[model samples]
Target: MGEDADVATSLADSVSEEIADRLAPVDAELARRYPGEPPTRQPVHTVYVPADAVSSGTVSAWGEQAREMLDEHAPDAVSFASVLGLPSHLAGPVHDRVRAKLEREPVEDLRIDFEDGYGRRPDSEEDAAAARAARLVADAFEDGSAPPCMGIRMKCMEADVRDRGIRTLDIFLTGLVDAGGLPGGLVLTLPKVSHPEQVAAMARLCGEFETARGLPEGRIGFEIQIETTQSILGPDGRATVALMIDAAGGRATSLHYGTFDYSAACGVSAEYQAMDHPVADHAKAVMQAAAAGTGVRLSDGSTNIVPSGRREQVHDAWRHHHALVRRSLARAYYQGWDMHPGHLPTRYAAVYAFYREGMERAAARLAAYTGNAGGDAAVMDEPATARALSNYLLRGLDCGALSSGEVARHSGLTRADLDALAGRATEAQVNSGP
Candidate 1:
C-alpha cells in the first residue's frame, strides 16, 4: 500500500510540471497585460484651467480663493458641518484638514485645457499659448510652486483638428525641452478620444517626440479621455475602452470620464447631465473594468455646477459637489475633475472624511492580518484583502488624511512596512533586504 501511494505522488508531480511548462506563455501574457496597480500617489482631484488663464499663480490663487470661501460662508466647523450635513464627530477634523490642505496643497494635479475650455484660435495664437504654457510650467517647477502633477490637455485627433493637435503638442513638448528639460511631474492628456486608433496615434506621437528630443523611450505618457459613447462600445459591439488601453501600448496613465460629453453623447438633456447620472455611471463602470489591474487609474468626471454667487447658491453647489465626490470615492474612483476654485474645499473635505472615517478600522484589519495583532476570528482576511487594507492605509498617508505617525502607531507598521505589504516596495528597498 505504501509503494502504491508513492507511485501516485510521483505521477502527480510530473503532471504538475507538464501543466506549468505548457502554461508558461499564458503566465507571461498575464503579467504583460495585468501589471497590477502602480505605487504612486494619485491626486484626489484634477483642476482644469483654460490654457490662456493658466498663470504662474493660478495654483496658489485657487487655494486662496477656496480659503476665502470657507472663511465667508462656513466660518466655523459647526456651520460647515451644517452646510454639508457632516457628522459632528467628523465636522471638526474634516473642516480643519480641509483648511490646512487648502493652505498647504490646494491643487494636487493641474491641467491646462486647450480643448473645450479654450476654444480654437488662430494657428499663431494657439502656438504662442502652448509655448507660454510650457514656459510657465517649467518656471513653476523651478520655483517649487508647481502642483505634484501639471500638464496640458490638447485637442482631439479628429480629421479636421488632427494636424492642429499634433502641432500644439509638438510646440508644447519642444518648449518644455528647451526650458531646461521637462518637469518630473509633467502630465499630458488627450481629450475626446473616441477610438483606439486615436489612442495609437497619441502613442506614436509620444514615441516620435521622445526620439526627436533625445529623451528616453516611454518617457511621455498621456491620459485617454473617455467621453464618447463609441469609446465605451465599439461598432463591433465589444468593449472599446479595453482596446483603447491596448492601443496605448502601455503609455496610458489614466482614463478620465467626461461627464457632460458622455452624457450628451448618450442623448441626455443638459439639465439631467451630471457625474452621477445613469449614463455617466455606465461609462465609468466600463472604464473601471477595462482599466482594472492594468496600472491605469480611473478618474470621475466633474460637475458643471460651479460654487459661486450668493451664499445659499454656493452652499447648494457645495452640497451637490461634495455628495458626488464622496459617491465617486465610495465607488473606488479616487480622482475627479474640479472645474472651479470653489470645488477645492469640498473636494478635500470629501477625500479627508472618506479616509479618516475608515482609517482606524483599516489599520486594525491590516495589523491583524500582518500578525501584528491577534486575528479577528469573526473576519478572516485573505492575502488579497490584506493588500487592499494596506493600500487603503497607504493612500490615506499619501493624501494627508492620516499622518505617518498615526498609521505607525495604529498598525504597528511604518510606511516602509506598509509599502512592502502593499506590494509597492521600490527595487532598491527590495534589494536591500531587512
Candidate 2:
C-alpha cells in the first residue's frame, strides 16, 4: 500500500506540472492586462458641479436643497427613512431620519467639470475658472467638507480641445499645490477618449505633471471615459477596450460609461439615448471585461431626468432615476453619475430599497451555506458566491444603507468578518504582487 501511494503521488506531481506549463502564459497575459490597486471607497455616484459652482460647501448646499425636495415629494418620513436601514420599530428622532442621512454625505464624489458642464468659455475665463476651482477644493479640504472622492473632468483630449484641457489641468493642479498641497483623494478624469493613443497620452501627461509638481510617481491617476463606439472598437476593427486600458500604463484608475455621447456615436436616436440603452450596455460590458480585477472601478452614466418643482413632473423624474440606478446596481455597477441635486432622494431610495429588500433572505442563505447547514438549495454558497454576498452587504454599509452592527447581527458576521469579506471580494484588483 505504501509503495502504491508513493507512485500515485509522483504521477500526480508530474501531470500537475505539465498542466501548469500549458496554462502559465494565459495567466501571465491576464496579469499584464490588469495591474493596480482599486480604491476602497469608490463613490456610488459622481455629482458634477460646474467649475463656477464648486465651493467648499457645495455638497452641503446642494444637499439641503435636495432634502427639501424630499420633504415636499417624499414626505412619508417613516417609510423613506426605513429604506436607509433605520428600524421601523425604533424610529424616533427627526435628525436620524432619511433626510438627515442623505445630507450627511449627499454627494460621495464631486467632479468640478471644465468641459461640457463648463461649456465654451474665453481662454482667459477658462483658466481663471480652473484656478478658482482649485481654491474651492482647498477650502473644502480645510473645512472638512471634502467628499471621500473628488476630481476634475477635463475637456476631451482631441486636437481641437487638447490644449485647453491641458491648460485647465495645469492651472487646477498648480493652484491646488500652491494653495496648501494637493488634497488627498484627488483624481483626474479624461473625457471623450476616441482611441487608445488618447489614453496613452493622458498617462504620459500625468507622469509629466507628477514629476513637475513634485508629487510621487503613480500619484496622479486618471479615469478614461469610454464614450464613443470607436473607443470600444479600435480603428483597426477590433475591440479596443483592453488596449485602451493597457495604454494607460498602470495609471488607469477607473472606467466611466458616457451614455449620451456613446449612443450618439453609434448613431442611436436621441429619443432612445439612455443609461439602459443597449449600446450603453455593450460599452459597459467591454469596460468590465477589460478592467475587471484590474483595480479599476466602473461607473454607469446618469439619467438626464431631473426632479422638478411641479408634483406631476417630480414623480416621473424620481421614477426614471430609480429605474436607472436599479439597473446599474443589478449589473454590479455600484457607482454611477448623478446629474442634479434632486436626484439624491431616489438615488438613496433605490439603493437602500435594493439592499434592504433582500437583506433577510441573503443573510439567512449566507449563514446556512457558510456553516454547511442543511438549508434550502440557495444555501449552497461557493467562494465567488460568498464574496459577492459579502460585497452586497458591504456596499450597503458604505453607502449608509446598512449599519455595521445590524449587518453583523443579521449575517452572523462580526465586524472583523465583514472587513475580511470585503477584502476577499475585492482582492481581484491586485493581479500583480507588491
lDDT of each: 0.90, 0.78
Give the range where candidate 1 is weakest over 10 consecutive residues by summed lDDT.
3-12
TM-score of each: 0.95, 0.87
RMSD of 1: 2.7
Model 1: residues with Cα > 4 Å off, grouped in runs? 1-7, 10-13, 374-377, 427-434
Candidate 1, residue 66: how far the Cα is off, in Å: 0.5
lDDT at 84, model 1: 90
How well is each residue in 1-434 modelled by candidate 1, as lDDT tens digits? 76556542436678999999999999999998987777678888899999998899998899999999999999999999899988899999999999999999999999998999999899999999999999989999999999999999999999999898999999999999998998878999998888999999999999999999899888899999999999999989999999999999999999999999999999999999999889888898999999988989999999989999999999999999999999999999999999889999999988888999998888888778778864344567988888888888888888888899888777888987887787775656534644
As for candidate 1, its clashing pairs are none
Model 2, which residues run further than 4 Å from truth? 1-39, 78-97, 372-378, 422-434
Instruction: Give residue 267's error in model 2 in angstroms.
Output: 1.8
lDDT by residue for model 2 (1-434), tens: 76567542437677989999999999898776643334366677888888877777788887898888877776675744543344564333332434666767888888999888889899999989998888888778777888888879999889999999998998998998898887777878999988889998888888898899888777778888888888888767788978888888888888999888899998999889999888888889888887777878889998887889687688778777877898899998998889888888778777777777667676666667557343335556786666677778777777777787776666677645754654543444333434
Q: Identify the candidate with maximal lDDT.
A: 1
